[model samples]
Structure formats: C-alpha cells, structure tokens
Target: MTERKPRKDAVRNREAVLAAADVLFTRCESPADVTMADIATAAGVGKGTLFRAFGDRTGLIRALYAARLEPVREAIEEGPPPLGPATPPLERVPALLDAVLCFKLDNRHLALALEGNGSDSPYRAEHYERWHTLLHDMLERIPGLTDSAFTAHALLAAVRADLVEHLAGHEGLPREEMRGHLASFAAALLGTRPRGG
Candidate 1:
C-alpha cells in the first residue's frame, strides 16, 4: 500500500520536539531529572504538544537512544562485517572492536558511563547480552566453542568497563594499538584471522 504523506506542519512540530529533546539531553547532566515542561519550553512548543509528540519522558528517552543507535546500525550493515565468503572469522575481530568503539563514542551517555566505570549495571548487562548475541552470530566458526554465546560473553567481559579503563587509561595504550592487539589475541585463539584492519 502507498504511504500517505504527513502534513508539513505536523512534520515541523515533530522536528521541533526532537530538536528540543536533543538539546536537553546534550546539555543536562542527568536525563532522569529533565521534565516534559522543560522540553516544551526549550522547544517553544506547548506542553500538550510535547506530550503529544513524545508520549512521555520514557518514550522520549527511547527515541533519543534509538536515534543515536541508528548510525551504529548503518555502520555495522555497511561499514564493516565479515565482508566476504573468503574472509576468515578472525578477520572480523578488528571490525567488531572498531564497531563497539564507534558506538561508545557516538553515545554521550555511554561515554560517560564508560568514564565512570558504570559498566556493571543491569542496563549495561543488556547491552552485553545484545553484543554477545551479535558476536556469536557473526563469529560462528571460532573453534573450541560448542557454545558461541558463552564465548561472546567472555569476550565482552574482557572488554568491560574496568578492563577498558585499564587498557586505554592506566595502561597508556593508544586506542588503535589496543584494538589491534585485542583483535589479534582473539583471532589467535580463534585460529583464523581476517586480512585487513
């Protein structure tokens, strides 16, 4: 079925609301403290319009997070992946590492969490679950693993908050060096390496 076109004013109103929310999220320290009226006033829209545009604060957060995740999604689909029928599983390791770094850089909240060593929460655990699922699906050929899911979880643990802080902060290693070394270490364990960094 053909999609009906939305009216111009309706589109403008939604854009205004999202723009306002973006500003608030970037400027505010704690997202939980921000209110609907705060968003409405910032956007120059009515409180009712803010509520109508984004049902509630939770809906707003979900939309905000999803918007941030979009580029990461596109990067995964088109920027890097296994890449070829001939590209070995180990070759994908660096791509995976790079992807995770990109995601962390893109999300300010996530970056803050990383800085604060806040990777142990239930919220972060959910991200690990999704990351592990994706890794298991992509690195299916890694040997010594009857269970790829279990291995993925282990790998994520290796790169978790404190570990990452040690690697990038305390250890004084360059981010690219850490990525290459970690990918190589994993690839060595996997027994197959991808050709490119």
Candidate 2:
C-alpha cells in the first residue's frame, strides 16, 4: 500500500490560508479579532477549507507561532555562539535568556496571544518545555548553583510574555535597558558579577 499525498489544490489552499492568517494576526491588535472566517475570506477560500487546513483557531495560532520561531530555534540548536550548543554554559545561559527576551519583544502581540490564550497554562506548551530544559541543563553546569531546576523556572518567569509586555508596553521600559537588567540578574546568580552591579 502506498501513502497518499495531499492534492495540489489542498497544498495551495493551505499555503494561502497560512499566509492570509499571518497577515491578519500581524495587523490585528488582538488575536481574537482575527477569526477563521476572516482568514478564509482573506485567503479566498471557504470556511470549510480553513477548518480543514487548520483544525481550529488555537491550532492555527500555534502553527503560525511555531513558523515564526523556526529561525530562532535553528540558531539556538545549531548556529554559532552564544546561542548555539558550542558556547560555554555560563555564557550560553545569559545568551539564551536574552534571545528569548528579544523574541518576546519582537513578537509581543503573538506571544501574548499564545501564552494568554486561556486554553491552558503556558507551562504546558512544548516550546516552554524545550526552553525550560535547556535553561535547566545550563544552570546545572554552573558551579555551586544548587536548585538549577527552580532557578531555570525563575529565570524564565522573569521573561514571561505578560511581564515583558507590562514592562515594555505598559511601563514604557526601553528594550536595551530591560535586556541589561536581565543579563545583570542572571550574572549575579552565576556568580560572574557582583550583585546589583
């Protein structure tokens, strides 16, 4: 028995839907404002096609978010330091957190939508687990750093989308300043810098 491939039209429609949805999400103030019907209309497809291409709104959002994150994931997974695996744990840990912060900053609205979608805890997200595990392992490599697991969670929480949005969007903190603050905070924990320096 041979596996059947998706029809050409189906492939085309799926691409159109994803492209349309990406544009809609990028322009919308809130993810909730971009409905499946809106995406279907924008993509020039029927509602049924939209649902068929992506199971539901959450599924679509997750897909879009994952697509946007692909480059960052690749850099972290294989590209050069300090995000790549070859970097020392001490240097890589802060770089990892910084990269995460910048990603949230760049994708503020989408990050907020996905993490605050209310379907479930952001902690349950696969990306969250990947990041947490990476950070945990890095933290464990630091000498005298007990509670690496809890420390990793704490570090990640500090950069949570909502908190970042609050600080950057609401409180009006500058991006570089926020990054500096996070780097300094992490440095203290790693004992690489003086506290509050």
Candidate 3:
C-alpha cells in the first residue's frame, strides 16, 4: 500500500528544523555546543518531534547534509543570481570558484560531519561527480583539450575543496588571490586561452 506522506505543515516544520540545525552547526566553532533540543527550539518545533524526526545527533548531521545539498548544487551548476545572463560563462568561472570557497568557509561544520561518513551516502559521490563533471565540461569548451577528461581531472584536483581551504585558511592566502589563482591555474591546465591568458 502507498503510505501517506506527512502533512504539509509537518514537512515545513521538518525543513525549519533542518535549516536551524544547519545554521547552528555550520556557524559554531565547536559543534559539540549544538544539541537536538537547541535545534528544536531554534526551529520552533517541539523537542519530541525533533527527536522523533531526526533520531539523534548523527541523524541531524545527515539531515543537514541533505538539506544543504540543493543550494550547493544549484550554486555550482546554475550560476548564482544577479550575475544573470550578462556574465559570460568563462567570465563567471572565477566568481563560481569564490562562491564555492565561500560556501565551504560558511559551512565548515557540515564538512566536519561528512568527515566520518564514508562513501555510503549518494550525496558525497554526487558532490565529487558534479565537480569533476563540471570541470570536464569547462575543459571541453576550452578549444584545446584533445583529451578533455584527463586535463579536466587534473584541473579539478587543483581546485579541490580541501586544497583551496588549506591554501586560503591555513596558509593565510587572501580569498581574492586564491580565486584568481584557481581560475588561472584551471585555464593553464586546460590550455585554454582565458580572457587574461
């Protein structure tokens, strides 16, 4: 039998709970400070429902990952708004890199949560594939890549999130410089004649 889904209000409450948890966890320097009850209060949902819906801390982390995914995917796959149709795809590339770095900087908590979860979830795989595929697509449009995938893979590794974060955060590189370097590096790897190249 087809089971009935939760009511619209219940779905909305679940979304709110996830969003509240996301904000709290992502912004907190110490993730241990976040609690289910705290998320429930912040989301304006009952504590019992929170527990029932998310089960526990790990559950909440998974929910946060799932909740955050759409926006991340959209930002990368679909150019962020305000840039609109005016920005050429190549021109928007550096902006996209900056947006990605900003997302990681803002949501370091979710990255921490994903640290332990292996390749079991489809989400992590999707994230990897999206970046790799996007890099491949960009490389193919380069008017050079006789072997686009190989060149694209190399470009992807260069600007991979961990490396970018290490350079920008730990190494104390300025964000603008990091973005510029990544864009330039990717163009070089693909042998693309970038605007400034």
Candidate 4:
C-alpha cells in the first residue's frame, strides 16, 4: 500500500499560513498581538482552515518555532565541528549551549510565545526534551562530569527563553556579553577552561 500525501492545496495553504505567521510574529511587538484571525487574514485562508491545519494558536506557535529551529537542529545533527557528532565532548558541550542561547536570543519573540503562552510547562515541550537529552548525552561523555542529568538541566536553564528575555530585554544586557557569560559558566561546569592568566 502507498502512503498518502497531503493534497497540493493543503501544501500551498500550509506554506502560505506559515509565511504569513512568520511575518506577523516578527513584526509584532508581542507574539500575543498576532492572533489566529490576523494570521488567517494575512494568509487569505478561512479561520476554519487555520484551525484545521494547526489545531489552535499553541499548535501553530509550536509549528512555527520548530520551523525556525530547523536549521539549528540540522547543524547540531549533521553539520561540522563544535556542534556536530564528531566534536570532542568538552568543545561540543559549550557549543551546543551557545547555539541554544543564540537561537533563543535571535528568536526571542517566538521563543517567548512558545514558552509563555500558558498552554503548559515549557519543560514539557518537545524541543526542551531534545535539547536536554542532547546536552545530557554530551555531558556524560566528559570526564569528571558526574551529574550529567542535573548539569544539563542547569546549563539549559541558563538559556531558557524567559531568563534570556529578562537579561536581554529587562536588564538590557548585550547579546555578545550574555553569550560570553553563558560560555564561561558552561566552561566552569565542564572544567574545560584554562587556568587564570
């Protein structure tokens, strides 16, 4: 038996909706400002179609966030060193956290929406699990890193969207400065930093 493919119109509609949502989310001051109705109007699709395609606002946000993260995920999964599988645990651990921090920083609005939209705990999100597992696995490979599970959670917590937003938006921290701080923190945990000058 052959697998079923989405109809051409469904594919077109999905692309249109995603494109419209990307623009709306990027342009709006807050993700809350971009509603399903607004997205439907922007995409020239009926509200029912939007609901059918994405289930609801939370689902749509998850889909959009996943789409935005595809490149980063691909890099970690298949690209070159510091993030790829071939990199040493000491190097890759910090690089993975850096990638996550940069992703949250770059997609602040989307990340904020997906994490703060009141659907459920951000801990329960699929992406969170993926990051946690990847970090945990990397930390396990590092010598002297005994609590890989807890350490993974701790490191990821530092880059959580809410915390990143607090530092970036509320505290007015610079992006590079925040990245540096996170890198230093991760280095300390992994015992990968060189001795003082």
Candidate 5:
C-alpha cells in the first residue's frame, strides 16, 4: 500500500514546533533549559501534539538535527568531489571531517541538544554510527592507514558537540581558526601537508 500523507495542519504544526524548538535551543545556555512545554508554548500548540509528533524530547531533537543535517548528508552521498564519493580517500576523509566540524560549529546549540540528552551515550545514536561507518570505510581505503575503526572514532572525537561548545563557547576559539586546527589535525593523521601550508 502507498504511504499516506499527513494532513496540512499536521505539517504546519510540525514546522511551527520545530521552529520554536530551534529558537529555544539556540538561545538557551543549556539544552536542558528548554523543555517540551516551552516548545509547545512557543509554537502555540498543545503538549499532546508535540508528544504525538515527536514521541519525546530526544525524538524531537533528533528530528531537528536530521533536518538540519540533510544537506551535508546529500553532499557526502552524491554531490561533487571532496565530500562526494568521487573524491580520493585521502582528500575525502579530511573533507568529510571538515564538513562535520563546520556543521557542528554552525549548529552548536541544536547539536548539543541531541548529543547531550543524557538518556543514552551519543556513540549509540544512529547518526553517530552512520558517520563512524562512513569514516571507517574511507579510512580503510587510504594506504598505510591502520585500525580504521579506532581512527574514525578518534577523528570524530575532535568534533564532538561538547568539545565544540567548550572550544567555541568557553575558549572562544575563532571559527576559521578552529577549522584550520582541525584541518591540520586531519592532515597530520592522513600523512598529508595541511591545506595551504
């Protein structure tokens, strides 16, 4: 059977809720500071609507994050070289890491909301597994690289949401500087010269 589409009102409500939650997450000092009730209030929707649409707080955050991450996913999966599959592994690996770092930097609040939910380890999240698997596969393709799994995990650790917040928020590292550092780190790991160096 064909899948049924949601009602127009349902679609509108979901967008409103997501927008409201985005604002709340962006402004709050901590993800825990923004609650479902706050989101419902900001969206002008009832609590039941949110629960029905998202299941729980974690569900809502994941949905929001996935929505925000769609472009990155598309680029990596099918777009042109560097991020796309057509690029060589050595180039693509650092490009992939750069993309992830940029995304986390751009969506620091939302990222923290999803990764710092405290209900479960972020490593177990579907998104994390996808990234790990992608990175592992790419790392394996690069000659002289060993322990692709551990290496992927280690590289990803540099861009973790908490660490991003600590660097960008607390340490006040400039965004370009952070990206530069990450690029250098990736280059060192891949036995490459840092970009523009």
Candidate 6:
C-alpha cells in the first residue's frame, strides 16, 4: 500500500506548533518554563493535539531542535569545505567543532533545554552521538592523533551547551573571542597552530 500524506490541517498544525514552540523557547527564562499547554495556546491548537502530534514536551523539544539543526546537519553531510565529507580530517574536525560551538551559541535556550532535559543524558542524545562519531572518525584519520574517542569527547565538551551558556551568558565573552579560543584549543590538541596564531 502507498503511504498516505498527512491531512492539510495536520500539516498546518505541526508547523504552527513548531513555530510557537520556537518562540516560547527563545523567550522563556528557562526551558522548563515553556510547557506543552503554553505551546498549544500559542499555536491555537488544543493540548491533546500537541501531545498527539509530539507525544510529550520532550518530544516537542526534540522536534523543534531537529528542525532548527537541519541546516547545520546538511552542511556537514553534503556542503562544501570545512564541513563537507571531502574536507581533510584536520580541517573538518575543527570546522565541525566550531559549527557545534556556533550552533549552541546561536540556540542557547533550545540547546540548553535539549541538553539539560533530565529524562536523558546529553551524552546519549542522538545528536551528541552523531557528532561524537563524526569527530572520532575524523580524529582517526589524522596522522599522529591518538585516543580519537576521548579527544572527540573532550573537544565536544569544550562546546557543551552549559559551558557555552556560562561563557557567553555569565562571563560575557565575545563571540569572536570564544571562537578564537576554541580554535586555539582544538589546534593544540591536533598538533597544529591555529591560523595566524
């Protein structure tokens, strides 16, 4: 049998709910502050519809996070240099980390919500595993880098959402400065000098 597409209203409701959740996540003081009911109200849908569509708050958050992260994922998977598959491991590794750092910086609230959700460990999240695997594989391609697994984890830890929040939100570090610091750190581990450093 052929797969059936969703009805028009279902499609519309999903988009509306995602948009409302996006706004709520961006504006809320904390991730937990934005609830399913609030998103339903904002999207002009009922709470049952929201739950039926997403399963629960965590499900909704994951969907929104995935939607927002699609571009970055596409870049890494298929786009040009620094992030694409064709890039050299050394170049791609740092580029990937930088992308993660930048993404977390850009989506502070959503990143925090996804990472901070107590129902699951951030390290075990599907996105985190994908990043770690990609980074680990890249690290293995470099001539002298050892402990590719640990190195990948360590590099990722530097850009963890909470750490990003602390540096960007609490310590007030400038974006360029943070990027520079991360580049320098990644270079030190990879046994190369950061460009111009």
Q: What is the TM-score of each candidate against the true structure?
A: 0.63, 0.91, 0.65, 0.95, 0.97, 0.97
TM match of model 1 to true structure: 0.63
**Candidate-wise lDDT, in order:** 0.62, 0.87, 0.65, 0.89, 0.94, 0.93
Compose the digit string of candidate 2's lDDT tens values, residues 58-83.
Answer: 88778888988898899999989989
The C-alpha RMSD of each candidate to the native structure, in angstroms, is: 5.1, 2.3, 4.5, 1.7, 0.9, 0.9
Model 6 TM-score, 2 decimals: 0.97
For 1-197, candidate 4 gives per-residue lDDT tens digits of: 99999999999999999999989988888888999999999999999999999999999989999999999999999999978999998888888888999999998988899989887888888999999999898888887779899999999899988999899999999998898899889878887782231
Candidate 1 global CA lDDT score: 0.62
Candidate 6 positional error at 130, Å: 0.7
Worst 10 residues of 2 by lDDT: 188-197
Stretches of candidate 1 above 4 Å error? Answer: 1-4, 80-87, 110-130, 156-197
Error of 4 at 156 (Å): 0.6
lDDT computed for candidate 5: 0.94
lDDT of 3 by residue, 1-197 (tens): 99998999888988999889878886776666787778889999888888788777777676776666667666555544423324554555445555556665566656555543453653345555666676566556645447867765665555554575567657998876776777777566544454455
Report residue 109 deviation for candidate 6 (angstroms): 0.3
Candidate 5 lDDT over 1-197, as tens digits, reads 99999999999999999999989988898888999999999999999999999999999999999998999999999999989999999889889999999999889999998898889989999999999999999999988988999999999999999999999999999999999999999988889987797
Judge candidate 4 at residue 8 and give its lDDT: 98
